[model samples]
Target: MIQLHEQGAYYFDDQIYLESEKKNDAWFDPEAGKKKTMAYKIMQAHNHSGNDRILELKFDSIASHDITFVGIIQTAKASGIEKFPIPYVLTNCHNSLCAVGGTINADDHFFGLSAAKKYGGTFVPPHVAVIHQYMREMMAGGGKMILGSDSHTRYGALGTMAIGEGGGELVKQLLNKTYDTHYPEIVGVHLTGKPKPGVGPQDVALSIIGKVFANGFVKNRVMEFIGPGIANLSVEFRNGIDVMTTETTCLSSIWATDTQVQDYLTTHCRGNDYKELKPENGAYYDRFITVDLDQMECMIALPFHPSNVFSIRELNENLEDILHETEVRGQALLEGSDVTFTLTDKIRNGRLFAEQGSIAGCAGGTYDNICAAANILSGKSVGNEEFSLSVYPASMPVYQCLMDNGSASALMTAGAIFKTAFCGPCFGGGDTPANNTLSIRHTTRNFIHREGSKPQDGQLSSVALMDARSIAASAVNHGLITAATELLQEEKAIPKYFFNKEIYENRVFQAHDQIQKDLPLRIGPNIAEWPEFNALTDDMLLKVTAVLKDPVTTTDELIPSGDTSSYRSNPIKLSEFTLSRKDPHYVPRAKAIREVELERLAGHDVRQTDEGLAAVYGSIQNHFPDFEYDKAIVGSVIYANKPGDGSAREQAASCQKVLGGYANIAKEYATKRYRSNLINWGILPLITPDEIELKNGDYILLRGVRKSLEEGSNRFEAYLVNEDLQKINLGMEALTADEIQILLAGCLINFNKKEVLV
Candidate 1:
């Protein structure tokens, strides 16, 4: 059903599938010998250098969900922020349910509403909307760039270049500082041909992800959608596929807008916001990926990752081998854990089946996908067996659309319990499965424990990603594995979509026309104030407490979302959970080092921090009369072979920062967003050289570290602060000019403040 060319192909106009050997010759005029490209033209149109390249972006609006907004606004407020400089939408989608964490979850919602009023912002009540969906309907406009705290914040399908970044980045935007970065290469995702009847956008997107992800073909590149296939897909179809582009690790995405896109904006009463954007005729691209939609088929992305993909046809034929390989890979990925996972067991009676099904989150919980699912499961029951189905509409408006179209009635009749918009299932806060159960879902991710099973607790469950139509088709047979393609018989009729914009008009609070007045914000006991941070010292020592070797580590694994949602507004309490879910030993180790920092901050004897440290400081004072323990700062650091892979959660870095983590020493970072989070939180993002062998708990003192950062020194020396306080030479790597300044000032917020005062 699916085929991949061994060599990559490029799209120039409607012609694709040309051999690489002929690519240069076909475009080159032999007599003139002139070669033109898309990237060269587009970059020239938008590119600026040095300080000018750093854009002072002004947003008309800002939107965030429960899992992120509290921390974002808190950070902004801490940086001397008063009155939001722009419109901000605080939506309660991620923590909409008060099921977990008792009163803390709802307490965050009230805090959000109060902050909106106090700061002259907007608030969307719980279950009212998901972050990205609401932004698309109300906030997105042509040629504007939006920044969200959620990682899946790609609204480019609506003609806006939206970026999903850590909360600190949002704080910088609120402070009127530029989003500093060198220009990024733009990649053309040229599409052609209409998708086959049964093929969904997820299948097409999965096909591209499988091909490009591992090779880093599109890493940190802007994917600009173009070509004829844009006309064949609806705006929602493009949006579903666009959100999953985060899996490819692209910097951001944008699409060439058309009348269909205009209609979507108009339907949401934003017609005036529409603007068509396209690259120049001879636009240069760093690389190009050409997709033929007619060749696409119903697909699946297997457990543990979104890029581990295969067609349903290939999976059914090679189930045993694939499952065996997956189990082996899982063991390797999890460091040979005692936990056992078996997918071959589902191959009973010559059919593959899953015990549960879910269609939720911003990626799957859309009106089109849900209604298509209802059409597929119309009269069929999901069965009275263990095979259960749950559906979460992306927003109240989408849910209202489903109800008006009778799709909600059809789904409920087939044993599907509809839920409100919540990001839990996508991040392991909802839809937990029984031990050893396999679930098929259309959510954003299927990372380990993301379905809410902790192997450390002796219970485990796994998830495989499928589109909503195929998920519902599997439910129709009560756990019998089936493809939606086979269910689309000639007699079956798929209903047309009818969107009603009135529901949004009645419910959503549009801040575009709201008047601003100085108001008092409601703060609860659970919402605590931030502790003051210190500036960088001339010398530093960090004890490496935890060492992780996972190929890629997500922020969810580092901090975990399900149980910690309640403590988000309270940093001191929430910091206790930092790395607790992944390491378990991380808390005590981090706390031990934090005690030393606390004592040093109070100008007390080292004994107050640790008796052992007091004795060591005495010895150092004897050697150098000027050596003062009271002036020194002590902190912890974590070493990961490679970490910071998923989500733009600033909490990952903020939690570490709050727990006396001065820096993260890593071989490399998984994504640019994560590294940016570290820098924003004043946690050094250091890259250890290949020859460097850092042991756990080895205290290395970085001498003149602050001076080196300010003086633009790329290489510096470090001393191994042993019992004798002996100095040793250690190598350091260079930092980008902006990064060095950010580190020297302690954080981005401080740097911006310094600039404003100057």
Candidate 2:
């Protein structure tokens, strides 16, 4: 169903060609070779770097959710930002549940309102819209580029190139600095054929994710949508699939715009933002992914990742073998933990059973997805047999549309609970299931502990990703894990979506033209300022605090979401939960090392704090006789196979920085945003070999660390100062000039502060 082109190809006359028929054709223009791509055109329009290969981009607008905007605004304010240089939208979605931290969530909302008034930005009230949905309804424009703090910020289906990145990048935009990066490769996602009646956008998305994620086929590249299949899908259908592109590890996505896109914009009252967007007839692509939509079936991604995909029919046919494999994998994922997971117990009789089903968030809560789900469950009911269902619309307008069209009533009549616009379910803040229960959801992620179950508390539940159609099908079958195609019912006609623009007009606080600089931000007792960070010294001493063997570590594991999101506005408070889910002992160990640094800073003898640390310093002194204890920086580090997988949350790195972390050693990073988060926080992203043996508490001392970075040296030599004090080699793969300065200045905020003072 999916074919991957291993090499570069060209698209001409609506067809892909690996080689041109005539090499000497006069139509081939060398000057336009790089400009033929739709991504290139859009990026060129926004590029301020002057060079085409390396992009210093300035976005048209930027967005942040409640869990992120507070930190972003704080960072910008610290960096001397007076007013927002571009349009900024602050939406309260992730932290809308004010009951979690005793008035903290509402305090964050009020802070957002005050910041918007002071900075001349826009603020969406709680439950008005999810970040991406609000951007789609109000901000997305043809050929425009937007950056968001949430990872699922993709609106390519609307002909806009949207990227989800770290809060540091947003702070740069707020400071009127450029987002620097090398031009990304473009991968062509050529679509053909039409989807079957029961198949939904999630089916197509999961199918593509399964084929590309493991192999890194589209990692850090742009996926440009093209071909005849583009016309077969509606704008909402395209959006459902587009938003899930974040799962494929692609940098961003874009689509060829036509009447369908223009109609979508016009219907949402953004007709002026519409523009024709398409690749030139002959455009080059680094790779091509051809998906035959006709062959798509109801797909389900097993627990732990969106890439672990299998057809619903295939899973039902081979329940025992598949379930056994998943159980074994889950056990290994929770290796040192006290939780025991079992998928076999969920099997009853001959069918696989799930305890819960959900259709919510940016991926599942669209107007068409809910309408189709309601149609499937129109007359059928989800029986009270230990299986329950819930649905959350993406925005107030969508909720109002569902209410007007009776979809909400139909879903409620079928024993499914209807909720307002919220993003809690997607990130585990709401509808968390019982221990060891299996939930089938259409949310963006299914990573470990993503369902809000705390394995540390002996509470472990799992989630499997599925389309809304199949989820409704499973609900109707009493959660027997049924596929939508098994019913063979006629397709129901869906009513046209009517957007209630007044909902946002009356409720949202737009501070664009009404800046109230004197407005005082209401602060809660739980909120706190960022802790002080030490700058990089000429020499460095790093202690390995924890070594993770997981193949891919997600941001959810690094700094958990859900109930812990209430503390995000307070950096010091949030840092306490760093690695709490994955490694509970990480914080105390890092703090212990931090105390040693504090002792050295206070002019105390380093040998008196800890005997083991003194011995390591003595071993380091043996290499350099003139090495002074006061000149060396003492901090902690961690080693992971590949970190930063799931969300674009900056806390993944900031929390580490707050705990006196100096570096992260890895074979490779999972996403660009994660690595950027580390760089922004002044944490060295060291690239290490896969087979290097380093354990927790092993001290590594680097001589002339700051000088090498300042001199633009990529490779650095260090010594392992444990009992087996040996020489080791480390390298910084690609550090931009600004990134080097950021690390040297301690962080982006410090760097910007120095610049402002000058």
Number of the top-ranking candidate, with lDDT as the measure: 2
Worst 10 residues of 2 by lDDT: 22-31
Residue-wise lDDT of candidate 1 within 657-756, one digit each (tens)? 8888888877777778888888877887776665445566666566577877878775555554566765543433545676677777777667666766
- What lDDT would each prediction earn against the true structure? 0.74, 0.89
Q: Any residue pairs clashing in model 1, and if so which?
A: 37-282, 37-283, 37-284, 38-283, 38-284, 39-283, 39-284, 39-285, 40-284
- Residue-wise C-alpha lDDT for candidate 2, range 523-589, written one tens digit per residue: 6777676777778998889999989998998999899988999999888889999988888999999
Give residue 501's lDDT in candidate 2 (0 to 100).
88
Q: In model 1, which runs have C-alpha deviations exceeding 4 angstroms?
A: 1-60, 336-338, 489-496, 513-517, 605-630, 719-739, 749-758
TM-score of 1: 0.90
- The candidate 1 region of ten consecutive residues with least summed lDDT is 30-39
lDDT of 1: 0.74
Q: How big is the positional error of residue 627 in model 2, measured in Å on the Cα after superposition?
A: 1.7
